[model samples]
Every structure is written in structure tokens, then in C-alpha cells.
Target: MDARLMDATFSRNQPSDARRLYDDRAIRYDNSWHPRFARHMVELARIHSGERVLDLACGTGLVTYPAANAVGPTGSVVAVDISTGMLAQAKAKQADHKHENVQLLQHSVTDLQSLLQLQGETFDVITCVSALVLLERPYEAVKQWATFLTRGGRMIVDVTHPESQISLITFERVGRKLGRPVPFYRVPFQSPDDARRLLEDGAGLRNVVVHSVSQMDIEGRDDLQAYLSDIQHPRIEQAFTIGDADRLFDKHITDWAAQSLANDDIKQKARAVFREEWVKLADASGQIREVDEVFVAIGWKQ
Candidate 1:
């Protein structure tokens, strides 16, 4: 689906343009550290054989495929995402891997309860990775998800720590440089406490547990250029259409350099260094080493 259709479909109630953004990012979504995060979320969810699983916003089936394998043929996984592009990629993966147990659906997470009711199905394990904060009504979505869980079933959600997200960092830095707020990158659940409260109070689930995990060591500087190229190209293209993104990015680096260096000449030199070796800048600033602080929240239905 193209951007025009996506916009037209969700135009009436477009508080969040996630569908369009994710549709644009669908092809390269897993190129970054997301696949590793998916594997970790699957492991943490402890999906067992013969258990039914629900993967909300199952972008490209990163978590869904792994969960399907863990559940084996006796089990099934219902993977749902709002973006058609993301679902298309996920369906292709399902076909390639012959994961008959996995089912891909194009639906918003906010409509999950209605979907579950229509099918009259419940899940032993429900997982939503890195997508909750994108929802228009995340608390309501969690409440709906809780209703679809079987007794004693677990619901696991992994929210990315804003500071650990390179995309958010870049957006914030650039937005500051432009002297404007980037509301798109601002998410509601900023900390583990926020997640816990939403699960326990908003969803009314029991025994809510929250923890953090990091995936910094997965891909080092060797894969940096390709990774950045894959992830940033689409975003930059989407964000800046009138001007050259490289030039804007260089200005962002120059502004960033000016903060640390007192000497004007040295700051200019620093900007040059940053522009030439910007991929390595993540490593230098400890961003790559602290790539993810994934806040995981698991709750159970009584």
C-alpha cells in the first residue's frame, strides 16, 4: 500500500500516524537491533509448547515466528499489526518458514478485544514488543489485552527506554537544533513504573512484574554503516524532503560538537571529525554500548 492510501484510510482519526510511518519502515524494521530484542522478549515470555500466543504489533513476525517455533505444531500464534506493509512482510516470512501455526492479521492493537471476541479465542501468552507506546490509547489497549488472556496466562510487553533509542535521540537533537518540538517521538510510558501502573491499575491485571534488559553487544561497529543506512534512510527521507538530509545532519553534528568544545576552531574540527566518522560517533558516545534498556512488564489474569 502507498502512503496516500494509508493516509486516506486513517485520515479521519489520525492522532498517531504510526501506520504510515511503520508501513514506510516495514522493509527495514528488523535491520536494526529489533530482531535481537524480539528473541529476548520471546525468551522472557517463556512461551511453552501447546500454548496459544498473541503477538500484538508483530512487525514482520520477529517475535511471532520465534514464539510459533517455541509453541510447536500443537500451538498457534495470532500475530496482528496495523500496517499492511508490515503484515505483508510477516506473511512472507511465515510462508518462507512454513510456519503453519502462525496467523497474520492486519488490525490495530486498540481493536484487539473485538477481534478476540469475534474469534472467541483466548491466549496463554500475549506479547507486544516496542509498539505499545505508539498506540493512541495504550492503557485501554492493555485493558483489552488482559481480557483475552486465559486464567493464569501471562501478558508480556517490552517498551524501549527513550534514552536508549538512537532514533529518539537523533530526533530530539535535531528538533532542538530546529527549535521545535517533535511530538512523534514523545511516548507516554517513560519508565518501568509507568508500565507497571498501566498494567496493574489500568488493565487490572495481577502480579505485574517489571524489569529491564539491554542488547548493546548484539551488533558492533562492523555492522554500523549498513544498519544506520537501512534504518535512517527512510526516516530522513520522510522527515526532510525539501533540503539535503546530509547537510542538515552535518549541521546537527556541528551543533552537537559546539557544546563540548570551548575553542571555536576546535569545534569546527570536531564537526569535521563527527561528519567523517559519524557512524563511529555512536560508539564513541557510549550510545552503541547502551543500545537498549527494554522495560519488560509481565502480568497475569486471575
Candidate 2:
């Protein structure tokens, strides 16, 4: 995804960035976070051949692709997002796979009525993944989405668990620096209880089931270590958040770039310092004591 596109969507238009970023970063996201999150919904929906599914905020076909596959040749997936760039990437990806079951659209969850109006359609199942947190009014969005589901049809949503927003901190060794404390992060709610109540009891969706999952990358995977190093990469100035902390220990790669390149000794020391400091921070935070949980809420249309 191009940074320009990301900035255009997220930073430029605060209200509509969700659609834009998904369009811009849709392809990049598939390799990073989409597959892991999509599995839960795909399983819950139990997409059978010939069934129809609506993937709201489908962002570059992460959930859409799998759902398309599950439904086999007979099923069709209407994957919607606001970003055309993201949809373009998804289309490119689909072209590569020769998948005919997936259809990409430029749409948002809040405008479901208009979307339905355009397509003259409804859905048997609707799924959204990690895209609801940005909604200014999630309840209203859910209520609108409810109209599209047939009775007994399912709506599965995955969002940042409220509990996942809390920060927990602690210390560990950074190379030779012993007992330096670091930030530990945790979320606040396993699920949004209030939202769940409103949708199930208030809005009339039924049989809401919230499932929690923690996909940890701390151990036994070279890929994760490489990815973590990149995430904490010095050139990246943006804060990577876990839980509700305002900031984590700074990864000031820019500050050390020149010295690190000019002197092997400097680079070694820099790596050691960062490694120990991050370890201490993670250990001190006490986040490792418990698995970080992401919530998946599944319900039937009333």
C-alpha cells in the first residue's frame, strides 16, 4: 500500500479513512493480518456451496477470498469497502487466482441501505473483521446492517477486544542493562458488552456468541521475530500500539542511523540496547502472563 494513499484516507479524511486505507493497503494487509482474523468468521459462517455472503469492510478481499473459496463454485461473496484502490488490489489478486466467486464494491457499513438499493439485494450472512472500531456510531451501523440479513441468517463481527486496549508494564534486561522496566500491554474488554446488549436485546439480533482468540507471535517463529524487528524498526516513527498506552519505549532508529552505519561497534551496541530494553519492557508489562484476546461476536438475524 502506498503511504500517500494511506495518508489520503486516514489522516486526510478522518471519517472515511477506514475505506481508503483498506483500499490502499488491501494487498499488503493480506500478507500481514487478514488471514489470521478471517479464519474465525469463515469458520463460524460455515459458508456452504451456493450460499451468499456479505463481507462488510471487506478491505481487499481478505475475508472475501476465503469465504469465496468455502462457498465453492456455486456461492458468491459481495465484498464491500470504501476504498477503490483497495478494491483494485483485491481485483488484481483475484485475477491472479482466477476466482470467480468474489465481487468487490466500494461501500461502507453505514450505507448499507444505499448499497442494497444499488444491488437490489440482501444477504444470508454478513461478516466484518477488525473494521468496526472506527465507526463513529457502531450501534447505528449494526442496526442498519441488520436489515440486510434474512431471518436466521448470521452476522459475525471481529473488532479490537475492549480489554485489548489496556496497557500493562514491567522491566527486563536490555543486554547488560538488568531490570530496566518496559511497558506491558493488555486490552480492556473481551468484547464490547454494551454494544452486544444493544444489538442482541435492543436491536433484535439473536443468539450472540462472543469468542476470544489470542494469536501470539513471541515464540518459536523466525518469521515473527523478523516481523517484530521490522515493526520496531528504527526508521518507522509511528507508534505501534498494544493496549491503551500513550507510547511504548521509543525505537529511535533515525537517531542512531548514521552512527550505526559508520561503525560496526556502534550498530552492535545499538541492537543490544534495543533488544534488552524491549525485552525488559515486555517482561515488566506482565502482558505475557495472559494471552491477548480478540473478540468475535456471532449472532443470528431476528
Best candidate, TM-score-wise?
1
RMSD of each: 10.5, 11.1
- lDDT (Cα, tens digit) per residue for candidate 1, span 199-240: 898778889887666645433532322222121112221222
Please estimate how well model 2 matches the true structure, expressed as its whole-model Cα lDDT: 0.55
Model 1, global lDDT:
0.65
**What is the C-alpha local distance difference test score of each model?**
0.65, 0.55
Q: Which residues of candidate 1, in runs, are more than 4 Å off?
A: 1-16, 116-118, 166-187, 219-291
Q: Encode model 2's per-residue lDDT on 113-151: one tens digit a residue.
A: 776433567788888776765565666778888787878
In terms of TM-score, how similar is model 1 to the real structure? 0.68
Taking all chains together, the TM-score of candidate 2 against the true structure is 0.64
What are the per-model numbers of colliding residue pairs? 0, 25
Q: What is the lDDT of residue 170 in candidate 2?
A: 18
